[model samples]
Target: MYKKILVAFDGSPYSQKALTAGIELARCCGSELHVLTVVSLPEYAGTVGEVEEMVGKAQDFYRKKLEKASQQAKTRGVELKIHLLFGHIGETIIRFAQEQECDLIIAGTRGWSPLQRLLMGSVSTYIVRHAPCAVLIEKGKEEDGNG
Candidate 1:
């Protein structure tokens, strides 16, 4: 029933799985696929020039990520749209999905332990809690390539 679907992806292998799954879903539902990547401000020393350099690299990274995902979706015969945003990862995802009127959001989970999750705050968890639409979290494949 989905008509527009948004997927949150980073360059991680886990996020790659989410892109794949989102593509399949979009194909099945004849939905428009929107792939979102957040170019976060790196947490470190930030001189003006250094900040500019980091932002440039982040832009390039997201550019490659969106291109890769778009190519994959093209091979599957689904129309794909790319979105890039800058801010806290979770907030950016939530805002974009709302603005685009996505029917569902598909995101990848990195499988952090309870203590670690508590320390680092999970993006998937945050999106699921805050998104106005339904959300699906996909865990990346195992070493054997099984689900």
Candidate 2:
């Protein structure tokens, strides 16, 4: 019963898997699909010009990734709205999901070890805990086959 679905995509293999799942779910439910890619800018330790150049390159990279995601959704007969966000990945995703009034949020996990997750803080974990809507995390291919 999802009317609006948001997928967090970063062009990684896991994210691509998440996109596929989101697209199929939207197709079956006839829901509006939205894809979001976030660019987490590193703390600037260089000159202003260097910071600007870094941001520019990141934007260009994300643009291409978003374009590819758009094409993939189109091929599946699903129209997708793309969003480019800058900020903390988890917070931005949760905020966008709320702002868009999304009914569901789909994301993919990198399957990190427990220690790594604890130290690095998983974005998927944060979104799962904080998202206003239902969160669907697509498991990695290895995990899917194993379990």
Candidate 3:
């Protein structure tokens, strides 16, 4: 029933699995696929030049990863749109999904421990609670060798 699908990708093994799932769903539903990678800004402290350099490197890395994802989607006969964003991950993802009018959001979770999740906050959880559309969280699976 989905018309547009957005997947949060970060080049992590978990996110790669999410991409695969998103691709399959898009292929079956004939939905448009959008892959988003967000690069968090460096912590405040370093010189402006250093901060810029770090951000630049992160952007480059995400670009390459997105390119690879694009190629994979193309091979599967699915057109993919890639988005690079900088900001708080959860907020940015929710905003982007809304802006794109996506019907569903597919995201991968690292399966952090309860304590760790409590301390660091869970992006998947936040998205599930706040996203404008439906959210599917692909928990990291041990058998998939991605957990």
Per TM-score, the best of the predicted structures is 3
Candidate 2 — which residues are off by over 4 angstroms?
A: 44-47, 141-147
Query: Which model scores highest in lDDT?
Result: 3
lDDT of each: 0.86, 0.87, 0.89
Candidate 2 weakest lDDT stretch, 10 residues:
138-147
The estimated TM-scores of all candidates read 0.90, 0.90, 0.91
Ranking by lDDT: 3, 2, 1
**Residue range with the least summed lDDT across 10 consecutive positions in model 1:** 138-147
- Model 3 over residues 13-119: C-alpha lDDT tens digits? 87988899999999999999999998777667468897788678988888888999999999999999999988889999999998889999999988889999999
What would the per-residue lDDT of candidate 1 be over residues 1-147, giving only the tens digit for each residue?
A: 999999898868888888889999999999989999987776675587877887788888778878978999999999899887777899999999888899899998887788988999999999989998999999644441122
Model 2 lDDT tens row, 43-147: 654677866776798789889889988988899899999988877789999999988899999999888898999999988999999999899998785445222
Q: How does residue 118 of candidate 1 score in lDDT?
A: 97
Candidate 3 residue-wise lDDT at 83: 90
